[model samples]
Every structure is written in C-alpha cells, then in structure tokens.
Target: MAMAAEEIEALITGGIPDARVEITDLAGDGDHYAARVVAESFRGMPRIKQHQAVYAALGGRMGGVLHALQLTTAVPE
Candidate 1:
C-alpha cells in the first residue's frame, strides 16, 4: 500500500513537534516521496541523525508500506 503525503507529514510532526515539514510526491505514485524537514530540535544533530529522526517518526513504515523517500533535514536558522 502507498502512503499519503498527509500521513507522512503527520507521522513526522507527531514525533518532532516543532518540525516544519513539507512533503512532495516525487513520482506521483504515492509510494515515492521527497520531504524537506526543518526543526529547532535538529540544530546540533548530524545529517545522518537528522534523517534518522524523520525515518523514526514514520514508525518503521519506510521500507514496507511507505517505500521510497528522498529526505532533507535542517535546523531552523
């Protein structure tokens, strides 16, 4: 099953309360997505850790129902 953009954003925001999340359907198939996430909590985190935080927010749905995601994360400046 493909995950919706709203679902993705909800999951991310649910975990990272102060996140500013923007989700895009890269392939228009609902399975592939691109996300840009900005949060104050990511300030001191490494890029890998930042990506991991977003992935963790999805609650283990990344490779299963969610499929592909090209994710970018940054701290609010």
Candidate 2:
C-alpha cells in the first residue's frame, strides 16, 4: 500500500507538534516522496538525527507502505 501525502504530514505533525512539514510526491506515485520538515526541536541536533526524527514519526513505514523518501530537515531560522 502506498501512503498519501496528508497521511505522512499528519503522522509527522502528530509526532512533532511544532513541526512545519512540506511533502511532495516526486514521482506522481504515493510510493515516492520528498519532505522538508522545519522545527525548533531540530536545533543542535545532527543532520542524521534530524532525519531519524522524521523517520521515527512515520512509525517504521519507511520501507513498507511508504517506499522512497528524500527528506530534509532544519531548525527554524
């Protein structure tokens, strides 16, 4: 099963209430996506950890219902 963009967004926001999330369907298919997430919580975190937070928000859906994701994360400027 493929994941919807809204579903992805909701999951992220659910995990990180203060996050600003933007999701794009890169392939016009629900299996592929790109997400840019900005949050105050990310400040002082390593880039790898930032990405991990987003993945954790998906609750292990990275390789199953959600196939490919090109993710970017940043703290609020």
Candidate 3:
C-alpha cells in the first residue's frame, strides 16, 4: 500500500525529533513526495549528506512504503 503524507511526515519528524518539515505531494499520488526539512542536525552537512540523513530517518522504507522522496534540507539560519 502507498503511504499517506501524514504517515511519512510522522515517520520523518518522529525519527529526527528536531526538524521542521514540510511535506508535499508533487503528482497527487501517494508514491511521490517532496519534503523540506530544516534542522540543527543538518548543520555543516553537504546537500547529498543532508538528503541522506533524512532518508536514514525512514529506516529502509525508501523503496516500499515510501516510494519516491525528493528532499531538501537546511540548517536553521
């Protein structure tokens, strides 16, 4: 089954605990999502690393319950 936005957001925020995340559906399908996360944990991280960190929060659900995730991360300014 495809995941819901709330389900995905909950998993990400719950896992990170210190993130300000905004989740969006790009294609109106549960399979596609874009997330912007701002967190102190991302400080000094590279763009790729930042995205990876967010993916890590999903615990290997990237290909299944969480189909496609386009992520943008930044440290709080």
Candidate 4:
C-alpha cells in the first residue's frame, strides 16, 4: 500500500511536535516521496541521527507502504 503525503506529515509531526515538515510526492505515485524536516530538536544532532529521527517518525513504513523517500533534515535557522 502506498502512503499519503498527509499521513507522512502527520507521522512526523506526531513524533516531533515542534517539527516543520514538507513532503513531496516525487513520482506522483504516493510510493515515492521527498521530505524536508526542520526542527529545533535536530540542532546538535548528527546528520545520521537527524535522518534517523525522521525515519523513526515513519514507524517502519519505509520499504513497505512507503517505497522510497529522499529525506532532508535541518535545524531551524
């Protein structure tokens, strides 16, 4: 099953209430997406951990409902 962009955003926001999330359906298929997430929580975190935080928000949906995700994370500027 493919995931909806709203679902993805909700999941992220659910996990990180302070997050600013932007999700794009790269293929217009719902299965492939690109996300840019910015949060104060990521300020001191490493890149890998920042990415991990976003993945954790997905709750293991990647490679299953969500086939592909190009993710970017950043601290609020």
> Candidate 3 on 1-77: residue-level lDDT in tens?
78898888888898889999899998998899999999998888898988887888888899888889888888999
Ranking by lDDT: 1, 2, 4, 3
For model 3 the local lDDT of residue 62 reads: 97
The sequence of per-residue lDDT tens digits that candidate 2 reaches over residues 1-77 is 89999999999999989999999999998899999999999999999998999999999999999999999999998
Q: Over the stretch 1-77, how does candidate 4's per-residue lDDT look in tens digits?
A: 88899999999999989999999999998888999999999988999999998899889998898899999999987
Worst 10 residues of 2 by lDDT: 49-58
Higher-scoring candidate on TM-score, 1 or 3: 1
Model 3 regions more than 4 Å off: none
Best by lDDT: 1
Mark the regions of model 2 whose C-alpha exceeds 4 Å error after superposition. none
The residue ranges of model 4 lying beyond 4 angstroms of the native Cα positions read: none
Tell me the whole-model lDDT of each prediction, alpha carbons only.
Answer: 0.95, 0.95, 0.87, 0.93
Total backbone clashes of candidate 1, pairs 3 or more residues apart or in separate chains: 0
lDDT over C-alpha atoms for residue 43 of model 3 = 86
- Which lDDT tens digits does candidate 1 get at residues 1-77? 89999999999999999999999999999999999999999998999999999989999999999999999999888
